[model samples]
Target chain A: MKLNERSVAHYALSNSPADHMGFLRTWGGPGTPPTPSGTGRRCWFVLKGNLLFSFESREGRAPLGLVVLEGCTVELAEAPVPEEFAFAICFDAPGVRPHLLAADGPAAQEAWVKALSRASFGYMRLVVRELESQLHDARQSLALHRHSSWKAIPSRCKPQAPDHLSRGLENGYALSRDCSSIGLAEEGGSRPAGSGLAECELQGPTNLLLGRGQSPVSPETSCFSTLHDWYGQEILKLRQGWLQRARGSQPECEEQDRP
Target chain B: MRYNEKELQALSRQPAELAAELGMRGPKKGSVVKRRLVKLVVNFLFYFRTDEAEPVGALLLEHCRITQEEPSGFSISFIEDPERKYHFECCSEEQCQEWMGALRRASYEFMRRSLIFYRNEIQKMTGKVGMGHGSGRGWLVAWLTLCCPPHRTPWSSSAYRKRPGSS
Candidate 1:
């Protein structure tokens, strides 16, 4: 029998933003209390549905110890300009001390670069992806920008007859200049029970309101093809937002992790 | 299309291969062939015949602007030289949109970086920004302090809320 193939790997944390401990300000530098940066107090991560589950604490059932990538920057040592705090390496603290390592040497200087690069990767990618999606959506919408347009009928818009859509309802298209929209007392008839008489005129571009109760149009088909379209867009926006966040917190995968 | 070995080697990331129906030269003139794979290496986009390395044609992204060509097409134009461009028709509208959007974004980033580089070079010549001055880092630290999470409220509940852009 073949067992699942697995191997151990090490993902060296980048010295910069990837390692920036927003919480552990006291125990920083080389070795103190490890700033639980990535998911888990250690390294490996898990994903439940679309949400990435990283270092979770028993105290907070929600994902705790999560790191967010704000941006990236590089620090220079032995610069032409002098500073108060040189390289401060405080890694010897007990359990998670937050401190900054002040590096004077060239080798130590690179640690700052690593940290910046690490922290900035996810931020940059998200920014780029967001821009890409925005541009794509803008261009797509531009296509539909001609004069007047309406969405194709969705399944939710299946025609269902109500007592009030009552002018010889045979065809789905209610070409009633009389019923103008769904419920403003057509010509002489009194406004129906549920539909609050909102003046809906066919002339207005966004005139389709789901008639309260008197619409011959089913609750599905009441508000034109717009409700479904709006819902779809909301879902898409939510997914994109969640994906951008998850991408920020997902564990850093190193070269060695590849089989 | 002559292959440049040294140039290919210098690319930072492995090339991402994609398939696109390339419309012949000019504005939506003719049909596009599905046979060729488009190679995206560094900041250049070009297509090679099969496994051959040399590009049959290449488009520099520096001044290129990818625009939707009215009804059913998209084209990229070089701003400096408008005549130099490639118009392609995607299999579907979405495919066309995604490819164009990605390329446009990459081009924008390239332009931004180039501008920064040029500005830095000018500064160096003028001796405004001295080496090892640590001005960049100083500015960065200030920005970070303003941006750090401590200054902002947690965004847990509204993380997945619908944003305005999608519609």
Candidate 2:
């Protein structure tokens, strides 16, 4: 989130109802669409209710995710807007938040009831935790970017040279390898922390935001629509392979699950 | 490494659940059964089964080795105790590839140690038989070092995972 964008995000978030909402000024997620070299644009997210919206241009916009909170995911291929690239939006990351609330439509009572129910409540709480952590990470990244005063350095992450990767460690895509079983202590045991947080991406605890991934942002959505879409699905996909493995487990492991 | 209910529910879902189902190797009672589940939390890939959700079997990546088998499967075993292995089989080469990729990425730090250890082992051989360019043993050791222990254990998850709505 840039300096100005943070203010808008703060207002939007602060003004809205406290439950089921989150906003972040994003630099885009993995596989963002291509953009021109230096656009200096960013995105504003309005995660209200079940919809996660990435409103572009920040001007007036017609009905989008706000139209409906139905759970069916669709890929909008820049239908009316020629200037936009196709993007997908989903109300549920599926296995990330499972609920008995059927796909009939908005189960207002059921959703609220499920929100208080055991599994669904857990799922919603988890989503809150995820968004909170993401918000924290975004703030931390912003802090790092402003580590030095702007008068001294416009941005902590100065755009590196095009051939930075070839320069090796100076400012490039450096990789660290490991083989030890996350080397846990010999005492007691470690649990899977939890599930559905499938992205389980190996983001380094030490200055990972400085890692070679964030591209210069622009107000243009074309570069980030795909990426945000990818982040939406991939972030929830890796850890919860049930959607993938469920196809095989029915008969293969039915006996084992019976007990 | 801290995850909430949703992630916990997800972990209790498939693949990991399938692993738990498969990891149930001992004799079982119909009414009361113990299921060991796979949890990739914080820095550790833990295996636990209990009424209280604790891992009964844990394998530290620091002392482990992954051996990919013929067709479509791989086994993660303790290097210190090879007999203790967590073997997995995939329906296809693709699934096998994903599992391997996730395992390696999760245990990357440990694998780095193995890389150093194996590279040093390869270096010892190259030193003994000088890099004659055409030296078969030297070349073989180098090739094995690249493909065998760490570098080319090519398991892919982020790449293999199917994208949503791209059909």
Clashes of each: 26, 29
| Candidate 2 segments exceeding 4 Å error | A1-259, B1-36, B49-52, B90-92, B108-167
Worst lDDT 10-window in candidate 2 chain A:
A171-180
Residues B89-166 of candidate 1 have per-residue lDDT tens digits of 666777776666556534324423322343354344334323332323232233333433432311111211222232
Give candidate 2's whole-model lDDT. 0.30
Whole-model lDDT per candidate:
0.31, 0.30
TM-scores of all predicted structures: 0.30, 0.24
Off by over 4 Å in 1: A1-123, A127-259, B1-21, B24-35, B39-46, B51-60, B67-73, B89-98, B110-142, B145-167
Model 2 CAPRI rating: incorrect
DockQ, per model, reads: 0.01, 0.02
State the iRMSD of every prediction, in order shown. Answer: 23.7, 21.3
Q: Tens digit of lDDT per residue, candidate 2, span A60-170?
A: 242122211222222222212222232322223344322111111223322222212111111222222232233322333344444534233212121221111112111
